[model samples]
Structures are given as structure tokens and as C-alpha cells.
Target: MAPARPVVPADLLAAVLRRDAAGPLVTHYDDRTGERVELSAATLANWVAKTANLLQDEFDVGPGSRVAVALPVHWQTAAVLLGVWSCGAAVVDTPAEDDGGLDDVDVVLAEQDRVAAVEELGVEELLGLSLHPLGAGMTGYAGAARDFALEVRVHGDHFVPYGPVDPAGPGLLLAGLELSLGGLVDVAGELADRLGVRAGDRVLVDARAAEEAGPVAWLLAPLAAGASLVVCRHPASDQLKRRAEAEGVTATLGLGLDGIRELGRPAPS
Candidate 1:
């Protein structure tokens, strides 16, 4: 019998874990900072588990809770999104600027620099990320917000949701669109097919594309297609070709590199 389709975004991660727990699932790069981080399926799942435990135990996040994520496209952001989905909570992709959409959220997670701005939203449960290469606590941060890096480390490595997650419950919220937990999985599969994300393909995606495409395209779609990701931030255009080659990338998104299979472009000569 065919395996049942994933009911939520977390199921995609579970599928990857079951397939190859030790294989690299998400690889991140920052050219400007000269930082590269790779997370195997098991490692990423552990982070998700810890983050979920922290949210559930500390902030009481659950199926009906709403989380506002005011961060960029990084490996940590992937964990945060998956953690929220695992808990059957809705994630609001809060804008970096102070546009004021977080007033109603139960928790707000923001980068250190953006904590001051997010604090104005009056979210009582606020956490800050340093985005450090080593996942260190926010340096020199003296804000009321809790440190996600420090707090999450003390949580359990395995997560068991307090209750069953409703597949039809709210999952993601963006500027003008909202998707239920089930809808996220459905759209991810559709996007993977539409984008030609073949199974076992190692996909390289630039930060601009990740931001423009959102989580469905940059994160979930690849996972849904059983592909691994090489995410680049502040990508140096001149070095992208070498980086793609080094990463063994079979597909490129938001980058124009010769001999690479770019999205919406003909195969390279």
C-alpha cells in the first residue's frame, strides 16, 4: 500500500528522518560572515524537539496558540517553524519592521536586534535569537526577552505533543495568506512538483529567493520532495558557481549560474 500523505509540515521532517537520519537535510551558508552550518535530519529534528519543548513548557504554546516569528531565512528559523507546527500552533511570519501585526500573538520570537521593535508589540512571551554561528546566547543583550539559545538547551531532546494536533487547525500566516496544518503539506507537495524538485536532488537556494518564496518554497517543498537543501545568505554572486559545485547542488533557485538547472530557466549548456 502507498504510504499515507503527510498531514502537516512536521510529517515532512519525519519522512526525512525515516529515510536518512544521518544525511544532511539542511546546509546553511553566509558568505558575508564566512559561516557554514550543516544539520543532518536527526540533528535538525533534535533542535525542533528542544524548541517545541521550550515553547510548550515555558510559554504554554499548544494547538490554539499563535507564534510570531520575526527572523530571517536561517537554519534556526527552520527549527522554529517546524517546532511550532509540531505543537500544532500557528506561525505568523511577522515582518522585521514594526508594522504591528504581533499584538494578538501568544509568543514572539525575534532576532536580537529586532527585540526592541517586537517588544513594542506588547507580546508578553518574547524570545530572542542571536543567530550566532555556534548557537550561543545573545551577546550583551540586556532586554526583557528570554534567550532562546540558552533556554532551549535545557529542554528534552525528544518531543511528544501534549495532545493530538488537528490537521485542519491553523498552521502558517503570512501577509495575505493563511494555511491550515493540512494545507501546508498539500501546498508543499504541489510546489515541489511545480518547481521540479526531484527526489534526492540537492537544491541550492539564495536568501533573496527564500524570502520571496517563503517557507513553502525554500524549506517545505524540498523536504516534501525528499530533497536536501543548501541555503545561502548574502550570497556572493561571483562565488555562487563555486559554492554550488562544492555543495554538489543539482538544482539552483534565485541564482543564475551557468551549467546549473535554475528554476524557470532552461538547463544550462
Candidate 2:
């Protein structure tokens, strides 16, 4: 029999439930405090669904809408990116360090820490990801920007796609060396199956890949497969190991030779 075709988010998410329905999908590790923060698949899905709904209802994010996510490597980052794609909109991969030429984006989903820098880009609305949920002051607040927490509370976990998306259309947009979309999707499919990544896998990715392979491999690949991803907020030798061990990382999708070496480096004696 021929291999089965991969289902898109709209068709797959509802049927998939293998991941930690109760455990954590994303775990944030703080080297300074040695703290670990977790977000389960169920919870992550809820957030993604709610956030997707808000983006569609409030920002009018749909086909042709480009949203920029300015977040470090973490669970929130993954959720925001997935949420954007779920709405059939393209995700603009903005450098966390710079926000230049973001005028074309209709919505800006940014991190609380980078709000000030993104503000300099002249975006009308900015969504800040907070530690807790807020009930108000999100939708069209202060002209355009809204708090992510507030948006989720008001927006329930129901993601309604504007229409059927063309697989050939732009799924993710990024700036860097150009690569063919067919090649990119093939790589993602290969890696997803090779790593045994499933809806239950809690993957920890090295930022090296996030910059090169684009967010498709780093974010959507596993997400579409029903796996949860945890991106370290910072890159540190010790921190990487702790995150891998603590989060029970099954595999890492590396981008280059240098990243592979760094990921495999031994601990200091």
C-alpha cells in the first residue's frame, strides 16, 4: 500500500490526541533560578486555538495577512507561530533583534521583553505574551495593540479557518538564502518520521535550525505531526543539557554542522 498523505492542521489537530494530554509539551528552563515552566499539548492547543481565534476576529488575520512573531525560542513562540498558520496566514519570521521593514504586516505578535524594540518599527497593534491571562484591555486597545492574555480570555478555543488553503501558497515567509518550498516540505517530512516525532514527542530545538531551515522545520513540522516543541530562551552549554534532560527531549532538528557539534559537546570536567 502507498504511504498516507500528511494532513494539514485543520484536518489533523482534532483527530490527533497522542501527545501528553496531561503532561507538558513545552518546558522553559531558567538557568538563573533553575526553574522549569511547562505547557501541555492540551493546554498548548487550547492557547493556540484561542490565540488563532483572536487573531482572526480582532486583527482580521486570514489569507494574505502577514503576522510577525517576535519571541525567543520557547513554548509561547511555537504557539503563536502555529496559531498564525492555523488561520491560513503566513508567519513573518522577524529577527528578535531587529524589526525593520515590518510595515507590511497587519498584526504583530511580539514578546513582552521585545515590545519596546518592535514599537520602534511603527506597528499599530502589538500583542504582548504575559504570564497570566487578562480579561480586558486587549482588543483594539490603545488604537491597535492588544495583550495576548486578554485576547485569549475573550476568545474561546475555536479556530475557524477562513477557507481551504492551497498547499502551494506561501505557508511561512522568512528572509535569508532562498530555498524551494517543495524541498523544504520534503525535509520536514523526512525529519518528522526519522526522529520518531509524533503528537506525543516533546521536542527541544536548537536555535541554529530556527534561523536557517525557517520556522517550518522548527515550529510547524512537529506541530503538524502533533508533537510539542520547547525552545530554550537562551543558548548556554549547561542550559541545553538541562532542558533536554528535564523536558525528556527525544530528538533535536539541527540546521548545520556547527550546531550538530555544539549539541553533542561533552560537559566540562
Candidate lDDT (C-alpha), each = 0.90, 0.62
Summed backbone clashes in each candidate are 0, 4
What lDDT tens digits, residue by residue, belong to model 1 across residues 176-223?
799999999999999888888899999999987788788888999999
Q: Taking the tens digit of each residue's C-alpha lDDT, what string does model 2 give over 85-150?
A: 678777778776577868888888776666767777788877876433222233322434567876
How does candidate 2 score on lDDT?
0.62
Q: Candidate 2: give the clashing pairs.
A: 19-200, 125-145, 126-145, 199-226
Off by over 4 Å in 2: 1-4, 9-20, 131-144, 176-187, 193-202, 207-213, 224-230, 235-246, 253-269
- On the 0 to 100 scale, the lDDT of residue 189 in model 1 is 93
Per-candidate TM-scores read 0.96, 0.73
Superposition TM-score, candidate 2 onto the true structure: 0.73
**Worst lDDT 10-window in candidate 1:** 260-269
* Stretches > 4 Å off in candidate 1: 1-3, 266-269
Instruction: State the displacement of the C-alpha of residue 179, model 1, in Å, after optimal TM-score superposition.
Output: 0.5
